[model samples]
Target chain A: MEQSFLAYLRGRTRNLPSVAVGIGDDAAVLNFPGTPEFPSTPESPATPDSADTPCLQQVACTDQIIDGVDFRSDSQPLASIGYKSIAINLSDIAAMGATPTAALVTLTLPSLNATEIAGEVYEGILEACAEFNVAVAGGDLSTYDGPLAISVTLLGTVTAPWLRTGAKEGDAIFVSGSLGGSLSGRHLRPIPRIELANRLRQHVNVNAAIDVSDGFSLDLDRMLASSRVGAELNIEQIPISDAAHAMSKDSNRSPLEHAWSDGEDFELIFTVDESDAAALEELSADDLSVNVTRVGSVVGRTGLWKRITGSKLERVFPQGYVHGETDE
Target chain B: MEQSFLAYLRGRTRNLPSVAVGIGDDAAVLNFPGTPEFPSTPESPATPDSADTPCLQQVACTDQIIDGVDFRSDSQPLASIGYKSIAINLSDIAAMGATPTAALVTLTLPSLNATEIAGEVYEGILEACAEFNVAVAGGDLSTYDGPLAISVTLLGTVTAPWLRTGAKEGDAIFVSGSLGGSLSGRHLRPIPRIELANRLRQHVNVNAAIDVSDGFSLDLDRMLASSRVGAELNIEQIPISDAAHAMSKDSNRSPLEHAWSDGEDFELIFTVDESDAAALEELSADDLSVNVTRVGSVVGRTGLWKRITGSKLERVFPQGYVHGETDE
Candidate 1:
């Protein structure tokens, strides 16, 4: 449903001038007619009264998660569900290399214990907002005879947004944090890579980026497909989390496949010019909130390929991984 | 659920200056750091590139509608459900006297026929956006084992926004369009009154305003409560719609009762100074897109009351009308 609907919407609204970035990416960036209030970067500190910069754009995206499918509403803490809802949307803004400002949350709740759930959920929402300094600008609450659904729309600002279509052949690809451990109860506590994205936005020439919400290989494929490019991943270089290794002990898939295909890691996959990728190594561990690993490079070849250090590159099989209801 | 949650949210986010208008209104008006893109009113007629006006505020509100509760998805046309979701949010913006700019739509789909429903819903969303000249700025899609829900967050620009807390003790109250017929199938096709709101923004000095999503008497009571005042409605002068009259034939309520107590009329209930109220009558019918009626007046008393043209006032009895899953 997500794929078919997104494709149809993209085909319908392809040439809209108001949309700087459209339906296929992490978030839609809109260029309203106005001068920027202040520079988005820290290169020059500007006050709110300052309007010396170029046009500013508004970035907006929403992600809706359900109870039975995304989480066990009956088993999980309501606060965790609320926190995940807002964090995933914040990740979408980070994927766009934008600063999150505010959010509008809509909760469609079941009729039983609605007030209790709403209050606890609001507590979680406030917790997430306080961490990001984002205002809970607006929201709606609805009750129905269904499982709880939390849909949050995060709004932000950007001047030079890193879009999915900007990556060219030969750009270096990097991903933040270890992956494939999310299903082991980490999905409810996502850490949006906002600070890393801000660092890249201020200091590097990022070509394209996406949050690994669906999976590493699948989301990387989406970004590559949108850019009309491909990538070559070094299988030996892909970082695996401890949870993945533990899950592999019981699961049919190996740790490597889990590292490549597990969803809701909330890590970031980004690309940069080779020159900037080289410069990225100079930053100490303290310079970043999360560890970033160089795993691949963009290529002109039209599909994903993987190879060990000494092996010939081979087409990466699909693995039949399902892209769930996860989105920006 | 709606009242208690709204009260809780209001108490939690009371004194944030960045939010020019907060939780207890049609929408949250945010004063972001920037000058105006263009004059929100027709009086100045400035272009977008010009920043010669005051600071611009963004009005954001979301309304989520679900099947079985807000509508019968299995019975109602899917397109009407989509249209109502967007239209209700648009009405929220109109209540703020803001011009619609863009919208973020989130669709939570039931597992079966998700793609087909999404397509039909998008058709309705596009149809509504075209009529209002609003850009479909962003959206997200998800599927779950629950009833379908459509939540739309409307973002708009406002220069001089009318709030729900500014009505003077003697202000004259007015409502747009005939009321009461909403549940007679009019609830599914709401009229946002955007043009009427724009007219009021451009010309009238609206003291306080609210959209009558609930019953007319109840919404009026809310605006008065926000204003710390009361209202005296002339029962005979209330504009009862033809649908209300038809519904009275079988319903256990009278037409007047229906006009005063039924919900989802999507009418605008507003207040103006007594002087400006007289001046409003000078405008011709073509100047406004909807019919305006002087149904009541703000009073110093503390609760809603009703009266005949020449009779004494009496307190209005609560009809046990549930507030339901509504709000900006």
Candidate 2:
């Protein structure tokens, strides 16, 4: 299988710049315009004073979506599979505040129409690349026993990459777009938020950031864990997605609970200094159609709590979505 | 399953630097160290005009190993499965003549022991990273109904990467180590020729190169195809692995036949100018225990043929395993 694919791939891939080295070598050789490490020696540069420069600081993350766990294979088309595969990686890049550059895809398919599946998947990848202006680059394909699965590794560049840390005690929390209710089909096709991220990178000095893929409570805990701090949320101010509101109306759960725990909302949950909030709000209005709302502050000790009534917030679900616990 | 795994991932991943924009944007914000379109400034030093000025280049490739196709689920151990997944990607990088820098992994699995599977797989990946000095940076994971599939994307850099198109008419064709009989188990544990690749990049201006993962005839055809030319193999000079010889002896097929058609050898096949033959041969002798032999030569013609009985070398199989071809 791999043999024939190699023959086909050698024929198909073309138009890359004159690579110093190409396929078939022990390793590939490439030629590129070199960048100075620092500003002083436009030639030699500052020699990269810090080990943490974005150039050296590698951004890597992996997310998993499963059949019956993340999607239904019987219903999801091959194009959706391909799009979703790359989309999820793009979302991770967005979460990191990085500009995606190259991507590598790995696929496992059943014996049925593997070539057609691959072609369709690549088509989906090409579409996403066009949308993001990034290259699909390269990837791996294999046959699997049971389900069709894809793993994509996307490369991105970060100039002043935002992190989950750096939030201060007085920081105000902001979220891009509404939260919750993604479980209703939107989970399958949620935008990765790449544009919103690019816009944020240009206009905001966000201290800490994370995309709300899991529930707000869980994702918030992640940010706080990185920041070595916690958040105090005003339940009344939480911007619940309309779908969450509708779901809450049918069930006994509050719209707040759905907002707190429903997964697959690819919105950005971020923290900014109090001084930057108003300007950020204005920028959000101008650049993002999505709502950027402030629902809480970074204060108190390192613990999560919600203030439904007033400043006196209460602890919500501590230890959001413990591994295997929910499955249990 | 994805949600739970992601929740765990958010916990395991540390907040690191180079985060031009950390985990919450549309796309990642990264600073690629150099200008894209122009020659390097005096300070940056444009590559010297020498024929051998090895330039920095990006080498990319991807592969997929599926259940039923790449491996039998219960047959291989989890640790081996994990190692093979990453190893396969690294092998592709090595084949590109590039030093792997990072990799992204995507996994789709049945709900069974997803994390355990991930842990084992990552353990394999981390081990390979430690061995190769590359990072297991990022990727996507999803579950499905079909089978356990692992896809990895390896990113690599090359000094003077080799190319298939660089093969000149009359350049000698050479392959590292022996070929054929990989199915005798070497296919499962094939070593990625990364070290050999690095060394070759340093010592030789390899004209054309490829790993013999596919059958020699087919893989050789691919190299010749990329060069837009034909090849004539000195069949008598082809190296046959003992395993391949043994297999042939058992099967009543000639060792020559297995050497020509067996897949998954993972050996490097390359071409270089005959003028540099002495230097390359000496270097291979000093650095690698394996033998590098001259097996064939590039020709002006555009078809692939073997050199048998004086001037007539008949056409062998065009290439090795093609994508989507049935395993049987």
- Candidates' lDDT values, in order? 0.81, 0.63
Instruction: Give the CA lDDT, 0 to 100, for residue B58 in model 1.
Output: 77
Candidate maximizing DockQ = 1
Model 1 Cα lDDT, one tens digit per residue, B107-220? 888777788888888788887887887777778877777888888988887766888898889999999999896887988889898999988765688988999887888888
Would you estimate the TM-scores of all the predictions? 0.90, 0.81
lDDT of 1 at B203: 68
lDDT, candidate 1, residue B166? 84
lDDT of 2 at A303: 78
Highest TM-score: give the candidate number. 1
In model 1, state the lDDT of residue A15.
41
Q: Please give, for residues A48-152, the per-residue lDDT of candidate 1 as tens digits.
A: 653544456778898888888778877899999999999999999999888887788888877777888888988899899888877787788877788888999
Interface RMSD of predicted model 1 = 6.4
Pairs of colliding residues, candidate 1 = none
